[model samples]
Target: MSQHTLLIEVGTEELPPKALKSLSQAFSQSIVNSLTAQGLDVGAVTSFAAPRRLAVSIAKVPSATPLNEVEMWGPPAHIAFDKDGEPTKAGIAFAQKNGVDINALSVANDGKIDKVFVQIKQGGDAVAALLAPIVEQALAELPIPKRMRWGAKRVEFVRPVHWLVMLHGDQIVDGQVMGLQSGRNSRGHRFHCNEAVPIATADNYAAALEAAYVLADYDARQQRIVSQVEACANQLGGIAQMAPSLLDEVTALVEWPVALAGKFESRFLAVPAEALISSMGEHQKYFHLTDTNGALLPYFITVANLESKDPAQVIDGNERVIRPRLSDAAFFFETDKKVSLESQRERLKNIVFQAKLGTIFDKTERVAKLAKSIAERVNGNAEKAERAGILCKSDLVTNMVGEFDTMQGIAGYYYALNDGEDNEVAQALNEQYLPRFAGDQLPQTQTGTLLALADRLDTLVGIFGIGQQPTGSKDPFALRRASLGVLRLLVEKQLPLDLRELLEAAIAQHAALPAADGLTDTVLQYMLDRFRAWYEDAQIAPEIFMAVSAKDLSQPLDIDNRVKAVQAFAQLPEADALAAANKRVANILAKLDQQPSQGVNTALLKDDAERALAEAITQQKSTIAPLFANSHYTEVLSSLAGMQSTVDTFFDQVMVMADDIAVRNNRLALLAELRALFLDVADISLLVRAKA
Candidate 1:
């Protein structure tokens, strides 16, 4: 078959900026998968996404699909032939169904029976003829949450489908996709070039659009925006603060991006930089500039789609638009400063945190008490923790936060400092919400750490207590994130707090819960289970976590240490045999109707292997006891590795079950002691042998 580049373009109105890149990728992959399934070789697929279109250019695609041979079987020969060996109804029907003469069907004899079969070869269609359906199917599978219909027609998409372009080499692929016939004409920039631009060949699609003032490549356009914005910032002797999400949205908003710098009144800088940045970036889609000291520069960069003849006019218009936004932020800052966080907190009483769980005020009160309790345990100032927790959500009622919801905790920090609260208390008000997402920074101050823990715990226990536990698909309250945040604070921060104890403290704060039965255990298990995913992401083996989890540990830091120790132990040469030996000992003890004796009787020991193992266990126990106490599990396991040989020799030479009942029980007691020593760290028996 001849090889050619195939281009498919779906033109529409502006797509959702955040989803544009994903849509383009999904579209390209779907077509590539379909081509491969058709036995057509395809090469590097280039996907292009913009405000008005999503397109893919596939290189080195074949002109026609390859033939595929399929075999069909018919009824048995005994059923297909009459007594005289003439064709029966079944034989004739099979041939007719296969569109062949009855005599053309061949009989095959097998060990079991004889049957008639036909080998049919299919597929040899021109690749261009199949392009339309493939494109349509790909569009149907796009990850659009909702699709809307344009005009009166029943067809729907993310946006109204305007044109479909399917080009193979220099020829147009003839088919209708999304109710639009295939064409070489694609519309360019809606304002700059309000006309159809003809694509002469599949390879010329990107170049053709660029000439018409549309950069079809998403990455190239994004790069251009970044460069332009940086150059604008550099011209003002400042660095541009470009958030990735905002940059992508701006790239999606423009065709031929022209970044221009606009200035706001420097007086507005009196407001917090985060509030001003939020106003410019979140509301206006502007990139803010920061100075050498990393302070806001009262300037913003905006990407314009069309290149204006008088660029100064565009810059002036943007400046005019941003002035009022800054003014509002300034006003909110001033209005909120007059009210102390203590007074603002009273407003929270009216705000419902959850219908059944009382108001936000109630939550704050509970968190304050829990914070005090947790602070006492974690060596934090209980007074500061309680003070911070009470005012943590107070900013939610502030005017600045009402206007800029992203400034919730941050607004509280500024207000608390203004109110002459302690420095740590002010910092904790902001830090309580730190590490909001994965890989985010955790609270640094002890008071902040305790308050963050107390806040998350209260929500988790209260929510779970009310029978609103998160399911596999839904977690509206973000309990999963909260649970992970709790684990991260405990493990990463090296806090020695126990999750079960904290949950109990939090549960006590609640007056009544509909599903209070086992609430502490349920929430604790759910939070601990979050560690499984966390460790899995770290590439630690599931069995390593399972071995540690088998202990039902409630202390995250301790569990983390044990997990690490087990991981280190699994790498030891003796890990597998010791694990197997432990498994064997466990099975022996489990089958006994009575519990084994607490201590092994030396007089009953007969076998040399049993005596040697008994001596080894006693010595290792004394050596590792201090190590285990200090949480130096790695060293303890390494020390235990020395006893693996004695364990193997004992298991191989000494039978655990003895004919004399007393001797069997004594041997069982010795094995039990060995198992308990290993269990102190982790159930090493669950460790899977590393693959050779």
Candidate 2:
């Protein structure tokens, strides 16, 4: 078998940055799995992705597996032979099908009487023949989240599959996918090098594409974009304040990146720096420049798809296009600032937050009230919470926010401070939306924390009350995020809040609205489910969660403490045995609860085992009661662990189901008490056993 290098390249229109990462990873894995399933040995498989192309290279891949003999079992000896030990019709047919003579047949006493079987040695085919089907299968099965139908057929992909290059050493792997045939041909930069480039092997995959004006590697292309932007900024005596996310987006927008500095009218800088940056980054994919003092400079960097004949003309065209966008931003900024934030609050009365719920203004009022109530409970400053809630949604009506929706909360802080509002009020207005994503920063100030929790709790309660709970990936209201933010605030801020009560208050406030009847329970339950999911994700044991969750999770800090106690208890050496004992006790109680039980009788405890178990329980009750009262769950669980041996001994030596009904009833009651004691920490039976 000869060693060969394999190369496959899929060329298409530019792909979104977020899509490129997932697509490339899927393509790479699919190809590797296909090759392995085909009995080929692949070494050092790698993948490269650009905005317009995805490529895979495999080095030192085997052509095929060597020939090996395989055995085929035939019919039983009795069936193959006749009554006189002569050849029968079945024998003749079997021998003929296997290309052997009937005389070659014989019987051997292995286990049962064995008959003749055929063994054939087969060799592999050419590498190209084996790889073609695998490559085709991988492409057909590649996972693309969003696909489009093109041409006559409804077959969909991220984009139209224009060309495919498949090679094995110096030979082309012949195949077809989606209406296109595989070959050595791949197109370069859509306009820079429109002609096809031929690749003979994986060795030339990258270099060949580079010469054809394609940077196949995504990281290399990103580096080029960054370096060129910096060099351009340096020439203009300013530094580019590049937005990392915008750079990533532009990196995936072009195959060959060329950065050029463009100028906008100086007057546009007078428009708040945020508006200018947002207009440039969000709309135009341009990097804004700032001087040493962090003031906005009148310069921006635009990434061109291709190098132009005259760089000055390209810069001039970009400036003309950008100036109009900045001017519009400036106009909106000036127009929006004329109205005080307080006035904007009044205008928000007409903007609907949800059609069934009410207007944004109504939602803000409820949130303001809720924030004040929560602040009082947590002993935070009530005045600041109320002020923050009122101004939080004011920015939503700003012209700057209308132009850039992502800057809603951020721009509000700047505007609020500019208007001479209290510093805490301005900070809280912005921090109300803190930790918008998983692992993002939570609110830092006490006032901000209180308002943030209230705002999120209000959204969760109102949406869930209207029967609009999130299902699967359909959380349009981001109720899950709001719930998580509430959890983080409670735990991080150590706020002793009752989540159930907060949710109830929010529901009650909304209940006066037209469609909010009977929604309080459903919304509260939804919030609880979110809490359960959050704990589960944090790797908290399910049994601990069930134990703590059985109570109201309204106070997130208390729930966290309970979870910590259970976790510490679970790590003990006798934890599993104790949990089993608790489960056994619970089961006995469950059966006893089906009928009335008489109280425990000391006289019925005739055996020493029963007396010893009863005494141990009596001793543990006093020890556990004080610990549980103090919320020292770790100490309570430790006391319960001491009952394992005594409980086991009683079960081993005493029969709980005695012949006398009274004795049996007494034993069951004792077990019930023991189980009740364990319940103070966790419902240990809910813990899933480890799989082997």
Note the Cα lDDT for every prediction shown.
Answer: 0.91, 0.79
Itemize residue pairs with steric clashes in candidate 2.
498-554, 499-554, 500-554
Question: For residues 1-692, could you state the per-residue lDDT of candidate 2 as single tens digits?
Answer: 78888888887777767667667878888888877765667889778898878888888877775566766567887788877988788888988887778887666555777765666555576667766566666666767656787788665777877888888787787876666788988887777898988885668888888898888887788899989999998998888887767877887788888898888889887877877888888888899888888888999999998878999999998888888888888788778777778888998998999987788998889888889888888788898898888888999989888888877887788778778889988988888988798788988888889889888888887776667778987999998888778888888877778777887777766755444665666766666666677777888756667766766555677777777887787788777777777767666667653643535678988889888888887898888888888778777877778777887888889888889988887888777766667766667655434200
Model 1 ranges off by over 4 Å: 70-116, 689-692
What are the RMSD figures for all models against the true structure?
2.1, 5.0
Candidate 1 at residue 637, lDDT? Answer: 91
The TM-score of candidate 1 is: 0.96
lDDT of 2 at 2: 81
Candidate 2's clash total is 3
lDDT of 1 by residue, 146-224 (tens): 9999898899899999999999889999999888999999988888999999999999999999999999999999999
- TM-score per candidate, in order? 0.96, 0.82
Model 1, residue 636: C-alpha shift (Å): 1.4
Q: Candidate 2, after superposition: displacement of residue 194 in Å?
A: 4.2
